[model samples]
Target: MLNLFSRNKQLLDEEIINWIFDSYDWAFKQFDPSVFFEETELVLPTNQYFPGEQNSINGMANLIFEQVKQHAGMTHWPTKLLNVTESEHQPVNPATLSVKGQLRGKQAQASFELGSSVEALSEDTKPTETKPAVTKATSTKTTSIKNNAFDESEYSTDLNLVMSAGHASEPNTGNNSINFSFHPQQLNSPEGLIAHFAQGLAQHLVSAAENPPPGGKEYLPVATELMGIFMGFGVIFANSAVVPRQGGCGGCGGGQSPVRQVVLNQDEATYALALFCCLKGIEKKQVVKHLKKHLRGLFKLALKDCERRLKQESRLSLSFAS
Candidate 1:
């Protein structure tokens, strides 16, 4: 179980909450109140460690499921979850599960392209890969300071490896001049977390479009209501983590210490990138195109894995009932 120690756990929880509020604030700014208030309620799952007993991953999942069902016109919930047969005592790591599933509702039948980078969109000309120059200053009288160039190549290599594994790229999709890159590093960094939350917002959008809940037009307002929740909370988390604040320094019993609290490590960035990719729409044609260019066999294997998981789940549930 994840431990909540010192103020770290509390801070992380607050950060997550702030992200939700920031999302809401942004929506209200645009004159959208549906998110803040809606008579209808949807059940969704939350993280297991969420404060209230009511707030859990299962709860959040249920909430999202209900919203999607209402939008999709699903009269009942998908109670038949893929029984996580894996050991609970062990550290929770979904990726480790050799088991994979492809529920009919969650299957990716479409393809998507990456948006251009923000820099690319703003600048008239495309950015050419340029190396940063490094210089060392030598002074006998003073400490010799070496202005070492940032190892951008190292960063690029790591980012490239992940992109290659995930098989995502910024292929201009249309007139949607949105340019963005899911840098694994950024997910942990100030910008990365914003991007991460944005990815969640994107996921909500994709989920809404792909899996609308049981309700018809009645829940549209509520679904969109979440937009503000996402924006408001996102901004707060980003600003609070990035903007430097002064506090008492340890060295001087009472001295000014400048510090930026939130930091995004590499792992977080990779997760964020995955989220971004998940949000991107995949067209059937694009999938076929990719198959033609890449290892067609592995693509089939991945799909087969999805099919096998769904079948296995169905079988397990049936066995339990019998």
Candidate 2:
């Protein structure tokens, strides 16, 4: 597996990295991803920034992921848009402020400020029609239903598909445990799976081309791996955070956009799937370990932010008492 990584990893990564960095250089004339994912720091009387940096981190992660997902395989997605900052407080140098950056699922091309929050948005339209499955010849085939009236056996098969898709559960269950799944829709055809990533690759070509990063060659392998991970992760579980997996992201909720927190452990399943797709290897232990690593990264970020907020609160209390 490491040999496989060593052999083709450079090509995979460099392709993604160059496209991203080049796109940014070509369009904006300035290589800054923050133009798409940026935060404005407001000057508070003591030292409190509402929404906080952690919130900024979370929001930026989501924003980058959204852009990567939508345009990751697009042919005509825009690479640059106007940069406008709207904030409550004025600062002398806004560019110096630190904010998180990511290019996960899709790119956010347009943004608007609504009172206290900033919203970056993009649009995509995919054909709703399902692709026809290719029929392959098999030596030993199950009996096909003749032009049917109500066939009990046929009814059983369809029912099984429904149940399998909806009722299957992960073996392990806990607060942080991931619910393992193999979506029936995807499992129906290998061609469908191939086409899915083909579309994704096309989307990423456009996305990375339009929104290239400054990291240069080092960026591609990680970005490709990241995208492969993102795609693979979407496959192993049915969730809304990463992609519109299991059609869960579409439901209505207070007219607000769906808020999905991709469980970090899901990345293990994702890594396994990507390897299977890209490298054709499956190691269960490796999958679990990768998932744990992703979870640790997320937990570390969340914990660090929580610590910072707590310290801020403590300092405020002392100041008030004084």
TM-score of model number 2: 0.21
What are the runs in model 2 whose C-alpha is more than 4 Å off?
A: 1-199, 206-208, 227-322
| Candidate 1 ranges beyond 4 A from true positions | 1-29, 39-172, 181-184, 188-191, 195-322
Task: At residue 302, give the lDDT of candidate 2.
Answer: 31
CA lDDT scores, all candidates in order:
0.24, 0.26
Give one digit per residue, the lDDT tens place, for model 1 in 145-169: 1111112321111111111122222
My TM-score estimates for the predictions, one after another, are 0.21, 0.21
> Compared with the true structure, what per-residue lDDT tens digits does model 2 show for residues 37-149?
23211111111111111123223222232233343322122222111132233111111111122222234232211122122221111211111111111110011212111
